[model samples]
Target: MIPDMTIGQLTTEASSRWGEIWDPRATRMTILLLCPRKERKMMELHGDMIEHGQPVMAVFHRPRAEAHLLEEQGFDPRAASFQFVNIATADMGPWMQQLVNNEGWLRSSIALNPTPFSVGLPSQRPFEAVQTLCFRHPSLPALEQYFLPYPAESLPGKCFVSLPRRAAAEMARQQAEVLGVGRLEKPQPPAPEPAPEPQPAPVAEAPSESQETEASEAEEPASQTPPEDTAEPPAEEHVSVPLPPTAKPDPAPAQAETPVPLPPTPGEASTESPAEDAPGDGELSGSENIDLPEVVEEAEEISELEVELRAFFQELIDAGVEPSAFMDDPRWEDISERAVAEGLETWPILLQMTAMG
Candidate 1:
């Protein structure tokens, strides 16, 4: 008959049964186990141990099957590690029940459905069917505040002591920041291309010299002269300077005083017309049109870049990374500009900086 024993008892019994030998007095424990999820928590605990002077050798990896199982359980595969699965208190299994219900053991039993693991012995021998054993170390007590209702088919396994409250909280915050920074979604489809605009009909030049001359003459007179009904310049007046004492006065007869015209200033309108108003050899003719579609395309490209930059900044904020930190850095502009030139997005650049730092 299978013995009904607590997981700790089973492990102790198995260690002896498997002939494994190790010094318990060692300051550090080498833990090689299967941790399908809860990697962050495990890492936090590891860090806490180091901080408290107990160094540990820990290796954790998710089995391919376990990851698939998480998805089947309606947990978002990406977020499963950070979340909890409810398990009934009664479902703690026979071994755990015996351990938790024991009056002598001051161990607290809470509903924390942490991932189970198959351990490696000091000799590195694999523990087969580790799932069948439920170990409860005195050092690793289940907290009452984190209790949850057990989900169907969920079973209890080994429960390790969680990091101290403050340490756990700090770890949680950092985990959230990392998740926010790394999250990515499907990119939207490209916008539809704009329709081609109608081209203006090409203007035909007059071939006959007589017709060209007539057109030129007509354009010249209309453009050069001001309208007669409009204000005309006043008749020019010449002011006479007073005769010097040594100079002779005019002896000619005093006739009607005719106004002498003043010289025109540089900006004043001239009555004479230019040779022609026609387009020169290299210049575009009056009938030529500007390609509006090309200008619109450039504007659209700039607008898209602006949108991408805004999204990248929002992601930085959500991740708890200061967007101003990057913005204030002199290299940020160069990095973004290079990304734009290569047709790459901004989030990759932001992610790289965080990873490097």
Candidate 2:
């Protein structure tokens, strides 16, 4: 009979034994055997099979059921082992159930269905599958939220129980179909060729001073020669007109218009005209000079704001968020509004920056 083991024990043993040989591309199933640590021969036999590239893994685990006991011994209760399998083929359900029932040497075990794109030990399949299932049934309120924080194997029963009858039946049928046949490997599409780097345009060299001088010298003679069509005008005959005498009395009448300057008023010294105290055409007044500094400061503030917004956008990109999706995120609404207020093109501008980079 198989002995009982906690989820933590199974994961700890599976990871320590078969961690290095875990290949998502080829590994179809992982079998954790709850056996004593002294079973070196069985472990060695499985290691040989792994070296030979078999799709099976048999790992020996020392069973510890209590979470507190496991933690006191420095074991992680949340670690999980995942195996990639093609859902279309691979008879996973029956074989795992049989292993659980018949094998006395196999103490405890669990099977995981890894997504096609999963790599290494961490699997996103549970969360992805839950989200997809929720989309198909809108009545389900984001089921992934509950499962994402725990190990995939720890909550499989609860996850299955939470599914509606129709979904559960469909899941069972799919599982049966997957377990009955062997998976055929699909051909991967070829990687795209990288674009070639652009070459710099060639610049034309300026003519040397000697060459310029020679060109001018060559053209000098052509300029100096007169056109064949040019001709001088004939001289005109001159005739003098009789002179008329001028009157001199108008100048005396203009001298009477000049008035004597006003004397200084009481308790006031004589001053120059107000126009003399005003600023010259090229110079600024004190208020105007102050305004120039304010204009400069406003421009500086705008430039600084632009720099900060660009940096914030870049940080989001670095965190693996796409610029096009920024509008969909509520956390970025304030930033988006600010960008609009500042007349920024937002996502399009970030897209251009990303492409350039």
Candidate 3:
């Protein structure tokens, strides 16, 4: 029978027996409880660890067969809870060692029998009379402890443990059910809203021949009108007499042909100044119109950059890396700098994209 012990005692015992096999430089530790798959029991143990502030990273359900293979294959479980852990500490080895040492509730919760499993037994076989615990690390041998009195009729499942932020924990629960591991106790995530489709730029159409003709015809009447302030003699005042043929005998026909000037409009000035009629320097003329093409080109460039940024985030997701946790990676610096230069709200955009996913 396993003795009851506090978290500190469990840590000390584990360190003394397996310290040599532990890698101090490792950033993560995987703990597997080979107990019966009972939701109530799993929740009790998870809640106890949380109540004691044990840095619980994540908790989910998986087939016992699959959980056992994790140690041998070294494959990532892709649990979302691990995203909350800050893995960028300088002395990750010591930090992880400390984490292992503090898992007293974890040790007590699964400690069933004092004897380890016999060598060469197929791990795939159902637990007949014993339960086991495993502490797996990358590049290091796994540390295991055995427990007794595993009920024969208990279902075949294992509770997987890790850390999670509040929302991420809820998501993990949902994923566990969706993947057919946990009880169908949580609701699936709602379908994501579709992303807005990009609209094409407007194309400028050339004027047709008929439209050009109508425009030119509209301008002819305006051009024919006289200036508003100009004065001219009435048609009635310019009558020619029948004596016009004989009038050519006048002494000087040139003097007689001299035109008469008419009085200016009542309130108008007689003096003309070309400068007063022309457009001022401050006013934009037809030749000095805005450079609209350059503005449109800039907008298009920003749109393309946004698309590229979204694709970069998608690549991270596909690779099972959390976008928030990837900030310390070298590749992120370039992306961040470019985003800042373009005035993009990187985090907001990333969150929106991830929500859709």
Candidate 4:
């Protein structure tokens, strides 16, 4: 039977054996607990971590055989209690490792173990995927420690650990879809209202005095009275009478005619002065002064002495190398001067300098 040890004694012995493994400055620890299919045990472990003042993030991996049992228990993957990950066909080690790395290790220590599952035979070895993950982390517990009673029993094949809350939630979402279990529906945002269309302005109507005058003159002839009838004697019996000469009607005074204005032809200017014809602030006009080039532009022109050198500098920046490194180099002055003359060639000098990194 295993002997019980005092808490203080345990701490002392732990410090002596694994002191270097845990950084004292770390305020939190990201713990990976495997095969924690039951909710109660997970809660217990979480409380234990909290008591130690370790900010814990846990991922519970359930086997395919126990999935129905979880569903029957009314297990909600979206619950805030703990994170969930599916492990039916996919390996859990690499997935967990990726999560831990992405979440980062700067603030916490990391620990991996399997629990609450039955142990396999002593000859059994952990999964290679788990071992690989552990090997990459310098602060992780020794592989031999994982072969003990608890981890061996729960995580039989591998010993990879730790997860972030966001990563765990994402994994749970993906696993729900894979298992044919539908996800919870998130409420969608309402669409924006459409803009109102502009209406056309009303047009004004002109007066119709010309039409009214034409209509009145047309009816005047038809409305006139007939002349009275009179009979006269034959020309032989008629007497001729001399009449006084009639004065010619005075000529009507000539009226002046108003002149209609006409649009000017091309190549002719209107009567308006040149000042009036000049463009106002609202009108587009050409700028008189030319702006100087940007600093980068000037630098590029100076560097143009070298062929393909500018492109190399651009590629270096794109590849995440510091631009200042090249600029600050002692060779830059000579190279810049030579580039103006020789145009820096790609082959002999540039390749040699680049390989120095």
| TM-score of each prediction | 0.16, 0.16, 0.17, 0.14
| Candidate 3: tens digits of C-alpha lDDT, residues 1-357 | 122322233333533433333233544333343222332343334433332212332233332333344444443333211111112233233334533575422232122232234433243233444443343323233333322223222212232222324534565677777788868457889999999999999999999999999999999999999979867767776677675454445475454567779876754543443455566643646558756664554544466667877888887888888766768667778888988898887888788878887
* Poorly placed runs, candidate 2 (over 4 Å): 1-27, 49-52, 55-357
Q: Over the stretch 44-118, how does candidate 2's per-residue lDDT look in tens digits?
A: 343222223222322222222323333454534334221211111143343334334544222322222233332
**Compared with the true structure, what per-residue lDDT tens digits does model 4 show for residues 256-278?**
99998997665455545455657
- C-alpha lDDT of residue 254 in model 2: 45
Record all residue pairs in model 4 with backbone atoms less than 3 Å apart, i.e. clashing. Answer: 119-153, 126-157, 127-157, 127-158, 305-339, 305-343, 306-343, 306-344
Which has the greatest lDDT?
3
Assess the local accuracy of residue 191 in candidate 1 as a C-alpha lDDT between 0 and 100: 100
Candidate 2 shows a clash count of: 4
Query: Which 10 consecutive positions of candidate 1 have the poorest summed lDDT?
Result: 146-155
Report lDDT (CA) for all predictions: 0.41, 0.42, 0.45, 0.41
Better of 2 and 3 by lDDT: 3
- State which candidate, 1 or 3, has the greater lDDT: 3
Single out the weakest 10-residue window by summed lDDT for candidate 2: 132-141
CA RMSD, predictions in order: 52.7, 45.2, 50.8, 41.0
Which whole-number lDDT from 0 to 100 does residue 41 have in model 3? Answer: 47
Quote the lDDT for 98 in model 3: 36
Stretches > 4 Å off in candidate 4: 1-18, 21-60, 76-157, 161-357
